[model samples]
Target: MGPVANVHADTLLIVGDSLSAAHGIEREAGWVALLRERVGDAHEVVNASISGDTTSGGAARLPDLLERHSPDIVLLELGGNDGLRGLSPQQMKLNLRTMIEKSQAADARVLLLGIEIPPNYGAAYTDAFRGVFRQLSEEYAVPLVPFILDGVALQDDMMQEDGIHPNAAAQPTILDNVWEKLGPMLSRDTDRNE
Candidate 1:
């Protein structure tokens, strides 16, 4: 993709799946919106997340989103759908890498938000899935939120009836997870406003 001349350092764009899309919850209740409130009125937060979106889909659609948002920071919260579909972690990593590269090419810093699938996927597969984000983050030299679910994942109260997506109560905690890794990565220009 060709480079775009405009990059909004105060703009935060999220390219992700259901979790970031607020699958079964209110859009205002999602972590991305909460983060906007936390970051204050200075930064523009754009949510490009879609339910059931795989990394491949994210990779494919990111170029346009990058150009449209001109984001300075891109938060990638995908791969759970890929793992659930039993897709290869190696290939998922490739897709994630492609998205990160595209974002970086557009002069936006990327933050990889990691996730893990159910144990039913088998230990080896699950472990490998987890490792993909770590490897990509280290290789790309980007900040990573190891697991966005954190303390909320398996808890019945924290999740929906499907036991996959987190409920509204878990959103604030989710925002904390993102903020931990994402806060330090915000540009110096936005840092002052935040």
Candidate 2:
């Protein structure tokens, strides 16, 4: 854990909702914390996730976060609340775009962590909801983790009683999912910083 020569190029900021917030688990046991441990002081990880936060909230709060942290990478794990609440996917997309643009303008690399709503929401609506992340990734040229909870969400043993959030045991898997995209980003950022 050496001192970072440039904080802005070594800090990793995560703006997300309950999933990233570690809603029903210990803070240190959450996937974000696991990510912190995995990085092992290579970069500072700041978790600014708020439970029940929507994309609109993240968009509204991003400028302050960017200005404060000057992160090299920004992970967005929002929109689950919006989908759960049946918010318009167009609005969600716009909000996400705003956040992405802001992060890019701030010179930070962006990673989109896509999430899916339950199948009960009807295929058309669910598809649109999921498509927002893909479209944004394409339009903005940012990396996307197609489904952050891909394996954990469906497994009963991995999920919490509410069935929405993953349990403590699932943290490692979540970190692995995020690391798939995030690892490369961190390497690139490190190379650039050096």
Candidate 3:
């Protein structure tokens, strides 16, 4: 008998804030763009990021995006705008959890991208905000990248004039950070189970 072959193109949906929205950067130069290069033709990436989007906003819009894209994987990169706006961490957690549940219900594998608050924000609130991602990752048992900006967030030269958002030059590093955890998930046979 001939060997059974398993080959199916996957789709990735990225939902996040300005970071993923390619704010002040060319769409082709953002990390998501770089990610496309890394994944190649094995997957189609649909970026649903919106500038200034919060977890609440992402939660609200997620269903529509999921319906439209019907992606195999969903990269959830929200909460940065919520932290910047000083919104309640609990509310951010709620919003993110709801979005994750909705994506899972639709049979999409999820990669939660965590973000850190600028040190200027009060330590307590920032810690709580950061903790939310960890808690949800544990709760949902999904893979998570500890910090999406890792190498770029602290580098002055890598940031934009506004002191937020990575410059085009730093996008490769961001893509690397995300791909470190996300790549294996995408390449694994289990991803096909979705």
| lDDT head-to-head 2 vs 3, winner | 2
Q: Between candidates 1 and 2, which one is better according to TM-score?
A: 2
- Tens-digit lDDT string for candidate 3 (103-170): 99999989999999997898899899989999999999999998999989879999999988899998
Candidate 3 lDDT at 37 equals 88
Q: Which residue segments of model 3 deviate by more than 4 Å?
A: 1-6, 190-194
Worst 10 residues of 2 by lDDT: 1-10
Model 1 spans with C-alpha error above 4 angstroms: 1-9, 190-194
**Every model: Cα RMSD to truth:** 4.7, 2.3, 3.6
Q: Rank the candidates by TM-score, best first.
A: 2, 3, 1
* Residues 53-88 of candidate 2: C-alpha lDDT, one tens digit per residue: 999999999999999999988999999999999999
Deviation in Å, model 1, residue 100 alpha carbon: 0.9
- Deviation (Å) of 24 in candidate 1: 0.8
The lDDT leader among the candidates is 2
Candidate 2, residue 190: how far the Cα is off, in Å: 2.9
lDDT tens string, model 1, 16-66?
A: 999999989999999988998988755789999999999999999999999
Of 1 and 3, the candidate ranking higher by TM-score: 3
Task: Tell me the spans in candidate 2 whose CA falls farther than 4 Å from its real position.
Answer: 1-9
lDDT of 2: 0.94
**TM-scores for all predictions:** 0.92, 0.95, 0.93
